[model samples]
Target chain A: MLARPAAEKGLNNYMNDMFAFDETDRKIVEQLRRNGRATNQQIAESLNLIASTVSTRIRRMEEAGMLRVVAVSDFAVHGYHILIHLAVQVSGRPALEVAEDLAVFPEVFAAHLVTGSYEISLLLTLRDIDELPPLITGTFAKVPGIKSMTPAVGLDIVRYALDTGPVDSRSAA
Target chain B: MSRPELDDLDRQLIGILAQDARVSNRKIASDLGVNEGTVRGRIKRLQQEKLIAFTALTGMKLEKAANIAFMAIQADTAHVRRIARDIADIPLVKAVMIMLGPFNVMATCLYHDLDDLHRLASGRILEVEGVTHVETSLVVKTVKISNRVVRITDADTLSQG
Candidate 1:
């Protein structure tokens, strides 16, 4: 209880110290977010910065681990028809251990050790609804932990993003 | 939705781009021991197919010093879809997933500070119409977050291996 908030604060401090981004960096990131394959010249033209500057800023930000330009694939288009959120309540075993174990499965898109009713929460992409039972009974059986699990099948994903912010703060930048 | 399968070359290109989206076509082609024309052509085809998208993904935790909250909402079933969209429009809500289970709506929200999260929960999220129950779980740590399959198991098997 005491440790979690403390850790959050420590994270804030670390981010402030090492990960702070200026206006230019934020704008570059925004442009890239719109189009990851955007060339430096294009970004510079759009942002009214020099091409060299854009490239330099990108390199700096990448080194700082503040941003990543990646290819995002749509699971639904590829026949992964079902996406489920699982909240697992752990009894005796550690929650992080369980999360790490579940992380190995290819279906798991994201896993988190959370603070609330459930210990470990997961976002899984499955081929079909039929895969659910075997995945839990067979795959999860290998993971040693005794507790309850709740599965929520996603009907419509209204909004899902791998990275959520900088909050359209190009004005500030 | 019928789509063309990604061959070995396509998967290799995607895997490489996933690591560094800004890598040049020439560089990638050289690394993969393929011609630049083939690499360039495949990337264009991949984009046209909408199988993959190159975008900027910020590490919110590191960039904003933010705390992400996972909120589960119990809402009236009749207006579930509308309610989910409304909540998604609210500031700081990154994801709003309409679900079938105990909770009808779920969202992953980001807050710059704890006060923002408090205001969101007590001030806005709870006040939304038809929202009967709002359960939030603060993400203490993110163990894994990947948008696509980091490892392509069997290109032939749609199961993602």
Candidate 2:
């Protein structure tokens, strides 16, 4: 597990301190869940409200730092055939610095400071198996303060989602 | 596509929907303490504005399948699109994208093993016109994967202001 960053402590505290949501907020969110790209007009029609009012609500939600919209590609359709996950252990530098360095690599899809034997976890895409040796021996090992690395390739993705379903009312109860 | 304007309420709504995509409009209205009609209106507007999009998430664990490889190709700028389209037609190719920096094209494919990967790279991928270089990385493991974007909603706001 990676050690939690000091800045994260403040962010986590803030999240915990946040209050609950009311009904309209929940409805707006549900519509977004179904289609992040759904038009404001369509949402208005679905929920039956004026366009500008819906726009205001969306603006408010954005200001609160709840969610975002982005283009998502099916990597499978692309030429990247190999997906490699690397759990890297670092010794000298701060984990965040290492994460920043790893992020510079275009092949690296995602990097996280996680909790476990490793300090950083990386998601990467590559063209073939031959590229692995160079990445491990050349790119990663060269990073200062890097101690060790463990990699786990995904064999099958059973179930995964960007968002964990709505906060259960039962959990609050 | 351009990013959209969003406020605090919009952020809250997105967060809620991110958690559960299936919640009803009535339920959402009830949770946010607003008229159901109002909730419905906002959702339509967000969709029309292209602020968010939804698609089924599908993934396969390549390690268990016995074959996996990453194919990087360098192609002439003019022909990159054509090459990408050709590669996409292959059955084993799972994903393809244009990248920045050293490489021009990055693709992921699934196969039986080393022999299978070799055949695809040499025969199918390399065969594409204008492909200058091909580099393959056999995935060892997957550490983390998520389609979520950071600051997608607010990053634009800060920039605009």
- Across B50-130, the per-residue lDDT of candidate 2 in tens digits comes to 444342121232022334456656878787777776776676665555554355666656677667777888988988888
The deviation in Å at residue A68 for candidate 2 is 18
Cα miss at A143, model 2 (Å)? 7.2
Model 2 collision count: 109
lDDT per residue for candidate 2 within A1-173, as digits (tens), equals 22235575345446733523345555666666555556777878888766665665555444344434332222332335676666678888987787778777767866666544567767677767788889878987767877877665643221123332112122100
TM-score of 1: 0.79
- How well is each residue in A3-73 modelled by candidate 1, as lDDT tens digits? 12456435544574465666777778878877788999998999888887887667656655566677766
How well does each candidate superpose onto the true structure, as a TM-score?
0.79, 0.44
